[model samples]
Target: MSVQEHRRLRELASMHFQSRCLHEACERGLFSELERSPGSAEELARRLHLHPQACRMLLDALTALALLQEREGLYSNAPIASRYLIEGTATDQGEMIAMYRRSMERWEKLAEALHCGHTPAPPSEPDPRFIHAMHCTASVHAPLVVEAVPRNNARRLLDLGGGPGTYSIRFLLTWPEAEARMLDLEPVVSIAQEYAEIAGVNERFEAVAGDYLESELGDGYDLVLLSNILHCNAPEGCQRLLKRAFACLRPGGRVVIHEFLRDGSLWPAVFALHMLLSTPGGDTYSESTLKGWLHEAGFGEPVVSRLEGTPSSVLVAARS
Candidate 1:
């Protein structure tokens, strides 16, 4: 390899070292402790019950990564960390990091999965942290999607696979007359209930606990949202879901599919790899493929648009 190529390859190969440091810090509540108050290495170690030497090393590494700031032997959360990494904040991503940590073990077996043609066995019960992580992610991007949706006299919505019902709550808040039914797994639906109650939309929001792939979806909905759901299945599964959504919506009602499009974006490519590692046949889809699926599912020509301020794009089609 050329000199520059060798250097680039080395940096890429060692990227996991940096990720491990960040994930470990988040797992250990380092950011939360710093958010409460700045402290020296020994002080933080004592508070979080870590060995002094290891804690000091982690603190220094976090500082180097710009997630923390250090001054005069004291460490504190950086502005970004304070806003998004500290637990209990409005935009806290602690749960998301925790979910990543939980997935790390499965991700480490990617090579084995490729050889065996399947992922490892799933846990018996759903992990609550994963649901919270989806909530955190949806809370940040739901508003962007809501703006893109057209809600003219739309009174009912079906949030298919709505993990935490963040989008449904936002939709309800945007259109006061609208009511929503969130369909998801039982464990995830329970979390959605809490979120709806907290948003004060429980009176208008209902949770349906079942698999979207196998459950019966009620009819006569003005809007059906398939946000972030398609990438969880293969193409045939996506077609089945689109057909189901088509069957459930009222005539002239719109079905919105929110997903990361394969349009040469770096993030989508990286997320596709993540799906490969974690799911049986999930991967990001192209816009042409989604449009074709919608057409096959009995929807009219779909309009594809990118959501502002988010990585996702939307395809809105109306049932004839």
Candidate 2:
């Protein structure tokens, strides 16, 4: 390979160094602290109980990463980090960073998992951290997705596998006349209710604690939303889930699917390997494959749209 290609490969290999630095910053609450109180490295180190020199080094690294800005020996969160890294902000993603940190161990076991066939069996109740991470990720994107969805006079909708119900809650915000029903595991649904209550949409939201695949989803709904749900299952299971979603919709009702579709992006291709490491049959699917599944499930021609600035895509199809 040419020297330029070699340099790029080296950068790719060591890119985890950057991620680890950001993860460490999240662990230490540095970004949030900087947002609330921008100060010199010495002051921050004293406040956060870090070694002075080490804190300065970290601060400089984060500044280099553009997540923080250093001005005249004082440091503060850059606009990007200020918006998404500060705790309790509407777009906070600290929990998501922690969740990714926790998943490192699982990713480390990829070789063994590949040798064997699957990762360890999932816990009966998912880690609460995972739910919180999903909430953070979803909350950041909910507005974009909720806007892209064609309301189609959807007075009622089903959020299948709606972890934390972030999208559903946001939908209620815009579609004031609409109500949302979310179905998931008991623990996840309980957490979803908490978020719904926090968003003040619980009155119009119903959280059902059950497996959506096997549960009885009442019919005649105006919409069904499957966000980040399809990629968790094998082909047969995905097809089955789509048919179940189909039956739960009324004639002319809409089904909206949101996922990290493989659309010639580096992220989705890598995410496919993540699925291989983490799931039995999950992978980043392509648009054609997804369209075929929707067609097989008896839906009319589907319209697909890519969410700007993200790998995730949304597909909307109608039941005739």
Candidate 3:
């Protein structure tokens, strides 16, 4: 291999190694320990009951990864790690990382999955761990979605496949007079209800439990939301769902889709890897596909807006 190619390979190996270390540290609560008390490697090893040499090497590696800092032999978690990576923090991304681990394992068989034109096994429900991951991730993204949607008190919003009612709750908070219905899987309804109650909008928000494709929706909603739902279905399923959403709206109603959309070109489909591992028939949709769907579904003036703080975008399609 050329020298540059060899250097890139080495860098990639190191990156994977560092990611593995982060996962291990997160699993073992090492970041939490450093948050409570900064210590030397020997001290941390004693506290964690790990081998001193191994702990030292790991801590040094983490320092190299910029996850920790060492000052005069004292090691401490970085601000980013302490604030967001620690277990008890609201922004703790451990659950998301753990979910990614499961998804990553499935994605390792990407070549086979693509060749078979099928996704790997679907996970059975009653999975508290996975559910928690979903809730945590939704909680992280809800605020952003609420901000992106056009603000209006008179708008009746429907959060289709709105897992955990995160976006719905945030919208209710943003506009107290706004009423929302969160439609999602039957099992996720309980989580959504809990979130609505916690957000103090249970009375205003209704939780609808059913499959989106089969559910009979009511009309007259000013805004219909489909956040992170399209990626769970195949192209046909998504097209059908969009058409269904379009039909369930009154004149001048708008459909809002919050998703990880790629640019017009299919180059660098980042979220494709996510769909490949997680959804049975799901795939990331492009802007053109979404715009075309909107047009075919009888929506006029489709506008795409990039979300402020995430890799997500909002597609607003208004009913004529």
Candidate 4:
């Protein structure tokens, strides 16, 4: 390789350096400390009870990375750090970043994972930290679903494989008379019930727990929602699910799928890598594919609309 190419490889391999800087800073509450006020390296070392010289070096590295700024011999978190890294903020994504590290650490086995066609390392269950992080994330995305799915006194809504239940809650809240049933894994269903109760909509929210493949979805729904769930399964799985959704809907009933969709040609989509990391068989497909599925599932021509301010689109089909 040329000199520049060799240097680039070295920089990419040093990815762990950035991860450690973020993780240690978060674990030590360094961002929160700096948010209160800038402090000299010695003062920071005393506050955090760390070795003064080592602390100064780490702080300087953070400054070099632009996560922090140094002026007048005092250090402060950068604006982005102060806004998104500090704990207790509505947009605090530090826990998620930490969780990413936990997952990425296992991805060091990417070669083995690829050879075996499976993740060589398994993540644990009852991962409450990841669950809470997902809940926070879903809450952040719920408003978009509410705005995308048209609501006009709908009596019932079915949220298929809805995680966190935030989308269903948002729907119920937006349309007071609407009732929703959430279908998901048992662990996530348990959490969803708690969210439903806390939202004071438990009476209108029912939890159906099981795998979507084997369970039969009951009929007579005015609206069926498959929000951000279709991409988790393969194309055949999506087809089966769509047909089942059509069968469960009342005649002329609406079925809406909110998903991170690619364009008709399926290029320039950032979330294609997401499928590589998460779903084993499924990958992001073009809007035309989704429209074809909706039509093949015995629905009329579907209308695809792009959601504003999000990497998502809504495909609405009417049962014929």
User: Mind giving the per-residue lDDT tens digits that candidate 2 earns over 1-320?
Assistant: 99999999999999888999999999988988997889999999998999999999999999999999999999998999988888777778889999888878878888887798778765667777898999988987888898788887899999999999999999999999999999998878889999999999999999998887799999999999999988888788889989999999999998999999887889888888777776778788899999999999999999888899888999999998
Q: lDDT of all the models against the reference?
A: 0.89, 0.90, 0.82, 0.80
| lDDT by residue for model 1 (117-200), tens | 767656646678888999888998888888888887999999998988999999999999999999988788888999999999
In candidate 3, stretches whose alpha carbon ends up further than 4 angstroms from where it belongs are 1-5, 124-126, 152-154, 264-268
Error of 1 at 200 (Å): 0.8
Q: Candidate 3: deviation at residue 196, Å?
A: 2.6
Taking all chains together, the TM-score of candidate 1 against the true structure is 0.94
lDDT of 3 at 288: 88
Lowest lDDT 10-mer window, candidate 4?
Answer: 264-273
lDDT score for candidate 3 against the true structure: 0.82
By TM-score, the better pick of 1 and 3 is: 1
Q: What's the C-alpha lDDT at position 101 in model 4?
A: 67
Pairs that collide, model 2: none
Q: Order the candidate numbers by lDDT, best to worst.
A: 2, 1, 3, 4
lDDT of 1: 0.89
Estimate, for each residue in 1-320, the C-alpha lDDT of model 3 and write its tens digit.
99999999999767667777888788878999999999999999999999999999999999998899999999999887987788966678888777766666776777887688766577745355665677777787778777766774446888888877788888898898889998877788888898789789999999988778888888888889998888878889998988998888888888989887866534228567667766777878888888988888899977788876667888888889
User: 230-273, model 4: which lDDT tens digit per residue?
Assistant: 78677999999899999999998989998878774333253554
Task: Give TM per candidate.
Answer: 0.94, 0.94, 0.91, 0.80
